[model samples]
Target: MSSRLYILLLVLLIATGGCRRGTDAPGIPEYDFMPLEAGRYRIYDVQETQYARNTLPLQHSYRLKETVGPAYTDVSGHRAYRLLRYRQTSNSLSWQPDSIWSVRLVNNEVIRTENGRDFVSLLYPVSNGLRWNGNRYNLWQSEEYEARNVGQPFSVSGKEFGETVTVIASNDSTLIGQTKRVDIYAHQIGMIYKERTYLQFCTDTPACLGKNQIEYGIRQIYRIQTYGKE
Candidate 1:
C-alpha cells in the first residue's frame, strides 16, 4: 500500500479507539457486588429493636465499623478474606473490637461466614428476580433468598451510587408468621443497608388471633454512615 493510504488507515484506527472510550460506548466494566480488597473499610450506624408479647419494646443504637484485612485460608481450605469489625455503643465515644468474619467467593457466589454460620450474600450475574438459597448451610430450614432492583441507583449518607442491589431472604410460607431479612448493597461498595424482621404468633389460640393481641417480634436495621479505604 502507498504511504498515504497507510497514514489514512492509522487515523481511522485512532478515531475508532477514541469512540470506544466515549460515555455512550458499551466497553465499560460491570460492578462487582463483593469487591474484597485489603485496606478498604465501611462504617455503618446500627439500630436494634426487640418486641415481645405483653412487654415493652427495647431499642438500642450503635455504630459498626468493618475493615478488610489480609487474606487467609479458611477451615475448608478455600482462600478467604478477613474482616475486622469494631463496635461503638451509644454510651461509648470510641470504637472497640467486636468480632472477626470471613468472606469467600465460591462457585460464583459471595459467602460470608459469621459465628460459625455460612450465608450466601450475593450471587453472580446479579439481575432482577434472581433467587437462591442464601441460608443453605445455616440453621434456618427452607429459606428462600432473592435479588431485586439490580443495577439501580441509590443514595446513602449523602453519597450517591450508580448501581445498587437488594437481597431478600424469607420462608416460603407465612401461615404461622413471617420472618424477612433484607440487605442492600451498593456497586463498587459493600453493604450499605440491612434490615431483619422476625414475628411469631400462636397459631392455635383464638386470643392470639385477636386484632389487638400482641405479637412477639424483633427488628434490626443497619445504615451506612461513612466509608473509605486506608
Candidate 2:
C-alpha cells in the first residue's frame, strides 16, 4: 500500500480501536478504567547505528517520578514529574522537569500541563531549543506548537517505541532547518526503552558539520529496563 494509504489506515484503526473517544468502546482494557497512578519509573535506552550507518549504540538509564495531585493549582490542578538520567559507562547525568502529564478520561486521551496551565498538548525540552510530545502521532490535535518540518503522513519507525521522547533545543531554531527530530519509546510501564537524539550544528564552531563534530547529543535515553514490579 502507498504511504498515504498506510497512514490513513493506521490513523483510522487507532481512532476506532487502539484509541477510544468514549467508554462505550468494546474490549476496553481493564487498565483503561483505572486512573493512572503516581509513581517512579526507570528507563533504559540504546541507539542502533550512525546517521549513515549503525554504530556505537550507547545505553543509559533514567529515573522518573510522577505525581497526580488531588487539588487544582491552575488548569486541571497540579501534576508533576521529574526525570534524572545517568549514563552507565561515563557517569554522566541529565535532568528534566518531569513536565506534568494527565489522561483524558472521556476519550482515554492523554494531556499535559506546564507551569500549572492545562494544554491539549505538551512540549518537553530535549536540549536548548526543541521539545517533544509522545502522543503527537496518536494525539487528536497538532495546533499548539509551530513545526516547520511538518509533513503529510509523518512516519515513525517501530524502533522508536518504548523510549523516552527526544528533541533538539528550541533556543537553537537554526538547527531546525537541518531536519532535526525527536525519537521516543516507552518501556517497562514507567520506563523509556529507547531515546536517542541528534542536532545539526549550523554554527562555525569546530563541532559544526564539516568542521568537527557534525552533530551533538542534544539528548539520549539509552536504558533497557530489564526487571520491574509486575
Candidate 3:
C-alpha cells in the first residue's frame, strides 16, 4: 500500500478502535453514566404489540412476577415455588440486582450463579429504573451506540410513545445482517402504558428472498410509582 494510503488507513483504524470511550463504529455513541442504580421502579410490559415472523403473525403470552424472597410463581403462572429472590442495589444513579439463585455483580465485573445451572442476570439502567442484562448489553451505552450496535438507529418513522427502541441480533446464516430497526416512543414519557412492544424485525430467508417479521409485545398492567423521600 502507498505511504499516504497506509497513513489514512491507520487513522481510520485508530478512530474505529473501541478504546475511544464509546467509538464502536461511525454511528455508536458512548453513554456517560453507570447503568444500574437502586430505589428505582420498573414496570414490566407483557404483550402489547404484534408483528409477522416468517410471514405468520405469532400470538404468545407469558406472566412474570417480582417476588420478595427466594421464590416465584411456577411456569403455569398459577403455582408458587421457592426459587430465588432478586435484591436491587445502586450508588449515585444506577441499580444492580442480586438474584437468590446464582449470579452477582461487583465492581463492574459480573459473576454467574455458584451452582452449575444456566441463569440470566439482571441490572438496571441509569435512566431511572429499567432492568436489562448482557442479552440487552447495548443498554450500557448511549442512545446512539445502543441503537446502532444492538439494534438500529431510532428514526422518526419508528417513533411511538416515549422513544421505543428495539434491536435484534441473530447469528443465523440464512439471515446475516438481516434487518434491524429502532422504534422511538417520545410521547408517552411519564405515563407507563399497559401494553407496549419492545422489539420487531423482518429479514430475508433462503434464495427465495422470503421475508419474515417477528415481534415481542408486552401487554402488561403495571405501575411505576416513585418512592423514597426526595
TM-score for all models, in order of appearance: 0.78, 0.35, 0.27
Superposed by TM-score, candidate 1 places the C-alpha of residue 212 at a distance from the truth, in angstroms, of 7.4
Ranking by lDDT: 1, 2, 3
Between candidates 1 and 2, the TM-score winner: 1
Local distance difference test, per candidate?
0.82, 0.37, 0.31
Against the correct fold, how does model 2 do in TM-score? 0.35
Q: Which ten residues in a row have the lowest lDDT in candidate 1?
A: 23-32
lDDT of 3 by residue, 1-230 (tens): 99999999999898777477464453311331112222222222233234444444454433222232232343435322232333233223332343443333343322233243322222222232233333433324322212222122333223333333322222122222232222221211212222233343334445433332343222233332221211
What is candidate 2's lDDT per residue for 1-230, written digit by digit as tens? 99999999988988887445565664333322123343434434344333321235344334443344343333434433322233333225554554544433224333443343344332322222333444354435443232222111222323333223332223233442233333232322332333434545445554553542434344444444442321
Clashes of 1: 0
Top-lDDT candidate index: 1
RMSD each, Å:
5.9, 14.7, 16.6
Model 3, residue 77: what's the lDDT?
51
- The TM-score between candidate 1 and the true structure equals 0.78
Where does the lowest 10-residue lDDT sum fall in candidate 2? 146-155
